[model samples]
Target: MSGEDFEDALKYTLQRKGWKLSTTKKTGDFGADLIGHDPKGRKVVIQAKRWNSKVGVDGVNQVIAAKAYYRADHAMLVTNQYLTNAAFELAKRTGVEVWSRKRLNAEIEANIPSKSNK
Candidate 1:
């Protein structure tokens, strides 16, 4: 999928989970893609990536950098593909949440709004 589509899904999933979503539009920038607050007002920073292949440790490093740069209380990396072993290890070591496509889709599905009420 395209980067924009992945970003939209990430925002939708977060919003459904009671997080406020904000976006940043930039090219070749080092900032996180979105900033948000949880239902209890905890700070969050998100980086959405649309990679046709596996995401590596470099992606995790960038997320970590952005998290620190923004002073966010929590951080997540939402990607369209699975992360490499190195990437997962890095995220684990740094306490960053990595959402793969399958996991992300499950979150989205679980939180999907019922159409019956609308």
Candidate 2:
């Protein structure tokens, strides 16, 4: 999927998980792709990356700045591909939730209604 598509998918998944989402403008977003409140009402800022190769620390850095810019309580980086070691380390140290493909798929799967239930 493209970057915007990835962001939309994540927004839908989060909405299903009870987040109130607000997508940023296509340009000059100040590094935020999605901004919203979590289930418990804490403000959250998210940066979504769709890349062919491993995602780097730039995504983490952007989300961190986005969090500060938005004054959000939480910051997260979601990527379709895996994160680099440096990205992971930085995210861990900065309390930025990094949702790589595995976790992203889990969240998607968790929210998808089973066919049997449909």
Q: Highest TM-score among the candidates is held by which one? A: 2
Clash totals for all models, in order?
A: 0, 0
- What tens digits encode model 2's per-residue C-alpha lDDT throughout 8-99? 99999999989999899999998899999999999999999989999888888999999999999999999889999999999999999989
Model 1 ranges off by over 4 Å: none
Candidate 1's TM-score? 0.88
Q: What's the TM-score of every candidate structure?
A: 0.88, 0.95
| Segments of candidate 2 deviating more than 4 angstroms | none
After TM-score superposition, the amount by which residue 69's alpha carbon in candidate 2 deviates from its true location, in angstroms, is: 0.5
The Cα error of candidate 1 at residue 73, in Å, is 0.9
**What is the lDDT, from 0 to 100, of the residue 20 in candidate 2?**
99
- Cα lDDT tens digits, model 1, 25-100, are 6664455888878788978788888988999988888879888887889888888789999999999989998888
